[model samples]
Target: MNIVLFGATGNIGKVILQEALDRGHHVTAIVRDPAKLSVQNPNLKVATGDLLRPASYEASLAGADAAIASVNDPDPDNVPKQAQVLLDTLAKAGVKRFAWVGGAGSLEVAPGVRVIDDPNFPPAWKPSAMGMVKALDVFRASKADIDWTFISPAAHIEPGERTGKYRVGGDQLLVDAQGNSHISQADYAIGLLDRLEKGDAARKRITLAY
Candidate 1:
């Protein structure tokens, strides 16, 4: 498959790039600076573009079998706008399958309650978390002709081993025996790729954790 990706320099995006290449898929990455993407693979191509301006990378999406975005706006307030731009541009580019690396804040921790609503939710993370929450809302309400899937990572995601062992859930946050919700970046990439290949969660949000 020819896959187009945004935010290829990010922690999660880079991992996704590697995973796609390892599977022998043709990947075209759209980046603000191509130099940041150090991965070298015969299947990988880098395109210089801006996330806020779709025309900058609009051509890259053409003929793409699927488009994945792991973008996080440097400005927390702009996340939703950036997300909308990617969605609209992909629609215009005629890509049918779209996968988004979303946030866990919007996942329900209990009936009618989200993680961001918890009193213990850190203030520092609230802005970005809410931005992702808004992005999810945009995807849900949009009427675009696309098969969109939003995968929310666990509350704690960082550089770690790719055990490729984890669990999946819908809407609700997944937790382990110790009541912890976390997943390694490597495993998260595997989960996202799995969804892209399976096409099981059309127009729905899925959560990953272990």
Candidate 2:
């Protein structure tokens, strides 16, 4: 498969890039800073472009099988706008499959309560998490030609060893007996790429945790 990825330099994006390359798929990463992507593979191609300027990379999406977006805008106000740009661009490029790295905050902890709204939720993480929640909605409401999938990582994701093993769930948060939600970055990458290859959670939000 030929995959076009946005935000190749981000935390989750880096692992996704490596997983795609390791699986022998052709990858074209669109990023603002190409230097940050240190992975070298014959199948890997890096294209310099900004998500805000979709026209700049329309050519890059041509002939691509799928697009996985991991773009993160620290500014709360810009998250939805950036997500829309990517979706619109992919739609115009005629790509049919789309998957985005999403957030767990939007997942309901209680009937109507969200993680981001929890009083115990960290103040520093609220902006980014809430942004992702909004972005998730944008993807869900899109009526474009693309078949989109939104993959939300576990509540606690960080660099860790990949056991090639993890649990999957839908909508609600995944937690263990100890009441913890976590997943290694490596495993998250594995899960995302696996779904990309199998077309598992088409047009839905699937989450990963312990």
The top-ranked prediction according to lDDT is 1
lDDT of each: 0.91, 0.88
Structure candidate 1, residue pairs in collision: none
Best TM-score among the predictions, by candidate number? 1
Clashes of each: 0, 0
Q: Candidate 2, which segments miss by more than 4 Å at Cα?
A: none
The global Cα lDDT (0 to 1) of model 1 is: 0.91
Q: Per-residue lDDT of 83-193 in model 2, one digit per residue for the tens?
A: 888888898888878889898899878888877888999999988888898888888888777778899888889999999998888888888889999999999999998
> Could you give the C-alpha RMSD of every candidate to the true structure, in order shown?
0.9, 1.1
Specify the poorest-scoring 10-residue window by lDDT in model 2: 71-80
The sequence of per-residue lDDT tens digits that candidate 1 reaches over residues 30-56 is 999998888889899999999898878
